[model samples]
Target: MTHASKTTTKLAEEYATPIFDHLTGHDDALYIPLLNHAQSQGDVSPVINLVRNEENFPYAIAHPLTGIICLLAVAESAYWVPIDRIAHSESCSSCAPIWRDLKNRVRTLKPGETFYAAATTHSPMGETRILIDAEDLEN
Candidate 1:
């Protein structure tokens, strides 16, 4: 496994909360669950009023090795799925709608799963999104 993966895994275990890929940006809706988990773990605050200003268990900004921003959301939260697009461009390339496929993909996500979608060398704006359980995604 890459050092970043190892670091993230270790951090996840230590924090006992899921760390999501941050490509979707900072949405309060997503932060709620994460804060709840931390609060449950004895964190003084339950709601994260300010992510950048956090004092305890600050959410990681990026994977240590991969340098990918980690979004982080609590498991089982009713969150909005990010819009999927082609690898390079921000536009969707599907002639036929793939809504069902995307929906199914999101539905299958569990607590320990890490959904990674980001740019790669081969494809600058990599379109392919990978959903691997925390156990399976380890480098």
Candidate 2:
């Protein structure tokens, strides 16, 4: 795990409080920010968002490469609320496909490359949470 401080300016631009970048499918523009945030901070735990409720339905993860794609079958502006790990464990089984695809992409990632996805009940939804290790990257 790693830790880093982020200024309000940076947060506003990336994690748009009232307006987010849009949690779309696995693309570069959507996921790159999450990866960049994690890489800059040296940890993936901080930038990841988890959604488990219907109120904050329709969430998308922004990618620096692919723009924005819907991850949870939600709209482009959906807001996702975070849930606990217990909920995540229980809901993850239903949400395995998303992570499986992300993992597959991770396997093909190169150095300085990044991926993003929405976290479900079981998986952490919202911004791109997974960051490939620098050493794992070929570049």
Candidate 3:
């Protein structure tokens, strides 16, 4: 790989709390810092408020490129919480469309390009967590 490809993104360095054996849909990801690495400066913007706290509903950081969630940013800010501290499973069938769409967009984007991401879950209502969207970065 080229040196640029080997270089990690700033987002992963600042956020991305690595995980071990956390279930995922993609390759053997030590974690989805790949999502952050995939992210570019000023790329992500929250679509909804993912609150992080005991009292609130659960949310996680997901990326279609990795096809898994590695970070949980909720309640206040993005990637503000260390993902390892949260308990989350791999991607579910319900959220497959999100991943599929993200993967499709990957075809067009140059490496190190930007994407938007977010995560929110409400099992009772059947809402799925999502992350990674190069095509929908503006939304």
lDDT (tens digit, per residue) of candidate 1 on 20-135: 32222344232222112212246321222222324533233333333443333222321111111101111223212333333344457665442442332211123322222232
* Candidate 2 per-residue C-alpha lDDT over 32-63 given as tens digits, one digit per residue, 9 for 90 to 100: 22233225455332233333257655444432
Worst 10 residues of 2 by lDDT: 81-90
Q: Candidate 2 local accuracy as lDDT?
A: 0.31
Query: RMSD for each model, in Å, please?
Result: 15.1, 14.5, 13.9
- lDDT of all the models against the reference? 0.30, 0.31, 0.37
Instruction: Give the TM-scores of the predictions, in the order they appear.
Output: 0.22, 0.28, 0.31
Q: Identify the leading candidate in terms of lDDT.
A: 3
Model 2 error, position 13 (Å)? 28
How far in Å is the alpha carbon of 95 misplaced in model 2? 0.7
Itemize residue pairs with steric clashes in candidate 3: 50-74, 50-75, 51-74, 51-75, 52-74, 52-75, 61-71, 62-131
